[model samples]
Target: GNQSGIPYSRGFECFDERFLGKPLVYCGTLGTIPVEVGGRPSERKEIEVGDWVVMCGGRIGKDGIHGATFSSEELRTESPAQAVQIGDPLTQRKLYEFILEARDTGLFRCITDNGAGGISCSFGEMGKYSGGCECELEGAPVKYEGLQPWEVLVSEAQERMTLAVQPEQRAAFEALAKQRDVEVAFMGTFNDSGYFTVKQEGMVVASLDMNFLYEDGCPTLDMPAVWKAPTVEAPVVPETADFSEVILALLSDLNLCSREYKSRMYDGEVKGLSVVKPFVGSQADVPSDATVLRVDYKSDRGAVLAEGINPWYSDIDTYAMTTSVIDEAVRRVIAVGGDLDRIAILDNFCWPDPVESEKTPDGAFKMAQLVRSCKALYDLTTLYKTPAVSGKDSCKNDSTRGGKKISIPPTLLISAVGQMVDVNQAVTMPFKAVDDMIYVIGETKAELGASSYYRWLAEQQGAAEAIGGQVPEVNGEQALSIYRAMNGATRQELLQSATTPTKGGLALALALATVGSGKGAEVDLSAISEGAVTALFSESNSRFLVSVKPDDAAVFESLFAGLPLILIGRVNAGEVLTIHGLATLDRETMRNRFKATLQGV
Candidate 1:
């Protein structure tokens, strides 16, 4: 999903190094926007000398000071007031409407998000765009009384925007904003003196020169780094696994199990536009590969949101890791009736400190990992012809305890937004009927290094490098073709349900689908790979598990003639899932194990 590597970046690195006590983490949707309306760059109006600087929508409070001073640092804990942004969807919808009016009426020249750095950061920069800005810091609207000038300038308030308006457009803009019932503040006016001059009432409080206040205020530091590879010992073949036990074990895995406990807490269908939700199926427990949301209640068009994450794969080979995640994201989106050409990518990276220090032992190695990931992202994205619209990065994903350092792997999240011409055409990952055939699209390989099977082995054995060899590889050209073929088949209703095999491989994927759909599966694993273990459990990139109707099976096979589409299974009326020579378990047994995966303390 992260193709160009330009839209998403390390733009916030300076702030990370300067003030992050604990780096903020991103958990929401990335830069994926609808393909049809995703805009082209338009001519930007220059900041005029007399433009009015106005604040719209939400007002400021003491809650956001740390966001300016720290970038919402100490991210995990609720200790800092700026650590979280409690959203108001109604207010957000109102602001969206107001901005639409602003866009249509040509009421604003330049706009900046009043997010990370309240007015001081956005307004201050806009001030320098023309030349300078003057006065009325005190005129800024706030939620409560008695805010310091610094507080008003730095609060990390939510649902707010700063816009530059022409002198004559002020009254009309104000009236429209009032008609929308949105709060407003006419803070100041732009000037040409190269200073961001601030005032309270009639007195000058702070007058900062444009250059020193922004560009040269903080200095950069260089640090020395050293990298050393860790020693590893080859591991023996996993003790012959008990087929049913292994299947149940995977179903019970924390990573593979249902996350409904957390996801069900959100307002998924608040606007009544969710066609395919986070949870699906008759029981509403099966996880949909992509979330399909209608653009508006009136339209049949919708957008698909699918995210790919593989932190374990990152340690073995970052390039493969990056490509694999991208492949995974695109695979899921296209499998669910999304167009391949309508794809947009967003990349979010979380890595250990690249700046060498006593706290960071292998900073250089981590930096190299980060660099390799970005290059792979660019190459894969360009190859797919999808561009990343926007992205974010958090560089210091690490912790120190008892004078020892523990750092996360170089992880990249590739989130894809794809368009579907009709919401009714979207497919969910569940068996539709008893007689349909199931196919495994794309190739399977012996790429088991950093896989969940090995991770599970490591967890049970306490040996990090015990399971060695085999890093996942993707043939980009081949992957793209396969995805296109699948999308074509899905659009034609030739495929009943399509899902990718990611974390736990084909075995886990098939089992989860069987349990989710409340149908039995009889998988014949001879055609894909040689070894039973490899065929059942090896984690392969760019692969899917799709169910197809018997009558349409020929058309589907014909569509993927050149690609690796293998007939490996079928939907059945029974409640058990059976993979010949590997595993077999009933629905209730698998369901109980997978249901409480994340519920365990």
Candidate 2:
């Protein structure tokens, strides 16, 4: 229930295989909206009939032509080169600062970012606040010459914002912009004429009724959707290899290995408020489940950010995939001192087109997958009481060339943001001290379908089978209770460190914990489960690997009295990790294997 939380990038996605068409790049930023700004309610627009419509920041360009329309259409051989917008970080930064100043000074009544459709969309949207608008296309500045009026109206130039200001504040606003060296233009005026009028060189170029343009201008589309479950070959279970070899192989994998080489390139402590950074360990190379940041210098309030994505699981069960990712996100937040009551999530869907067309005859199965994914989203969010504030979807993500088609596995990335009362109580993913007790916080079953272990085994056996067993499902009620108990333990300062067993599951989780602490551990799976494979590599939901001091074991156990938990090990001073009667490996050896895959990049 934090009123002022901000979410930023938390991790990096790496790839080792080639793909068709252009590479997909994603950037997401989120922030909390204030109830009021500059003594005015933020949600209410104050645009009057005589207010001036101002365009501030960058000038017009032809680079981003069809930026909005192209995204809604399918990719083709002739996709325009001008659809991609080139960004200017320096100018954007300056504009960002200026907007803050303007906001504090009450220079504008309403503001919106000039993204997507540029002026045509921004001005049109703002016109709804008032009755209509009259735009003068001739007044807009351009980067170059020979730009048509229509192009100027729709050009998706970067680093720009649209504002609504009173006529009396024009001089003051212009003076401030000049002082700040930001471009400002008076391109239009709000009116009550019920029509959007565009003029160039004192001649009317376009005029349309606001009602028709906003409501009835576009025709309704009817798409056919039929649901049929897809069938995939069940993979044969290969012989279980030695635990040490399987652990090392999983650590050396492209998707499971270290990403510190690339993560170090970004500035994680830009504001000097990052309490728990992206990488936290004795060596500062191990990835953290979630990052904790101090909200500001004046308060001890903290915000937590974490993300979860498992596109491979969509091949088996998209509903379970959706549930698992949401659980992962919430578990990561809890791992770093966040509570279930304050967590909120965001969903991003990247799927192939699901229409019954000539190019896609098997579109019904994909449609069914999407529907099941959405149904899971609805059920889990409600059950967890984590509301989704905003989300986006891209439907056409397939490419076809020479009668061969390639479609991305359906992906749904879930991001969670939550707040905690104190930043000092936050924890990292590592063993804090030697002789600390280790425990698994939830039940692990034989659910390894589309898991990293199965994928690694498939590659080892030279088999193309990447799916098997059962896709893990989430129990929202049980998870919520475990998270609450974890929060309670965190408040009492009874836990040393915590992390979830994701991707590579319990084995990788333990190896990473050892790598982060620069210490070894003695673990025994006999008390947790009888089968070593299920106990070590099953990708079960709502599970955590937590370390506790031996002195606090009684109190910790009392707090988690009814939860599914078991004390299975203890941290040690030796340099080798010993899983009693199973296997043992040197700490440095395991670290090298984890860092080998992405060492240079």
Candidate 3:
């Protein structure tokens, strides 16, 4: 049984059997020296000790080694079973030499050794990777003993292979292997027909269709969602004594905690260059923020970010949910110091089947919203030189439980990719040092239609008027200017300029700060837009929490030019949070809230 969720289970085991221990010994000899090993002259010569021998074909004995002798007397008295008569090791050596020669000559696109299961497993996998091809087994070279058709099929022969060679180079390849003292055999030609055929002496022994053998039979799953609007009450002024406490409450939420535990298992250094690893100290993973990848002097670094949202709780909230996906993906890249102008988008649509007529038309409605949102993003990306690179769809996310079919919540995943001119200037989620200034760049609104806060705090079920309020459109020209200005900034410079768009607006910013520094952040939001304060604090899309140097303020302002660049607050020196104008909360309280919620407080 599998302990982990992984589909496959594998391990090693050992056991003890009660018996008297004894040394097992055996011997073997050669009937004739292989043609590649000096032929008949080598066979007539006396066998010498330390000569390595191998079974070239068939299973004639249990040990496979025919016989070996330390003296002439031992050789004369050894029985056929005791005296192991095996093939020449020189023949196997020739095969190895031939492969190297072929590689040098560029005769094969790919090749692999054939050991157990004869031609089946080795050739089967190779054929699949090669887009399917036929291999003939009759042309195989065998030792002196006549092999039965079935024996040849399952023969555990040493020094053999099911090589893939082009028609033009087959003759030269054979001559090269022969010169190296290896046997070169042509099994079959590659074909696109997608079939595997085995033959012995020009007679068919086994055949199988590639389609049936290669295709996985597992069925696609329809994971349903049973969504009920959360029943928590919204934060009233009386619910919390100070606004700073509320900010701390939001920061300590389960959704905002770092996921380093899961991320550490990944091998981010496999490719030798990981600009931004998944987990960095205290920073949380932000869906759809640009993940910058840089490691060299030249601009080869890339960025990736993703986001998913569910909006079944609101009547008219589906569109907002869709837009949120796009917004989050883009913002993620930006948070990690991505070039917004060179970004690309990938959309993943996971929803209930639209064909199912018996259920409420939530599936169709969500699908429509997704299409519209994608079209909107398409236009934006095209204007900004960002394109849609790839996408995936998972429909029919409905499951049956207790003899009842249920549909899952509306979910959408949006991914964005971008290029970074210099990874050295990349900004990451975590803060590098303390005392860096924090700022919220985008304008926030009061929209809270299908927000997690509404579901978790207010405990509301039905949609509210504020669900899809006014969405802040991206100022492309302004975004372009800011991106250009920050292109040459260093990690330290970025930390000094960090800021938060509190509520969910600065969620990405807060995550970046947390990652940059394990310690909690202290930022003032007094300079942000008061009209959209709630939205800024909440998780609205298209917002950013930027860190800028006080001295670079003029340069930053010049970069924004005509864009909406709000100087909200600066990073404090201690482990306490201060929001609005007067509210303050210590880090201990914030940490408790965050940790407790993860365990379902």
Please report the candidate that would top lDDT against the real structure. Answer: 2
Ranking the candidates on TM-score from highest down gives 2, 1, 3
lDDT of 3 by residue, 562-581 (tens): 65566655555566555555
RMSD of 3: 17.8
In terms of TM-score, which candidate is strongest?
2
lDDT of 2 by residue, 488-567 (tens): 99999988999999998898988899989988899998776777877888899999999999999999999989999999
Give the runs in model 3 whose Cα sits over 4 Å from its true position.
1-242, 269-272, 281-291, 294-319, 359-367, 430-436, 460-503, 507-523, 531-536, 595-601
Candidate 1 lDDT tens digits, 322-414: 988998888879878899999988998877778755556566778777777888999999999879888877776665444455566676888
Clashing pairs in 2: none
Task: Order candidates by lDDT, high to low.
Answer: 2, 1, 3
Error of model 1, residue 504, in angstroms: 0.3
lDDT of 2 at 452: 91
Summed backbone clashes in each candidate are 2, 0, 57
In model 3, what is the error at residue 390, expressed in angstroms? 2.2
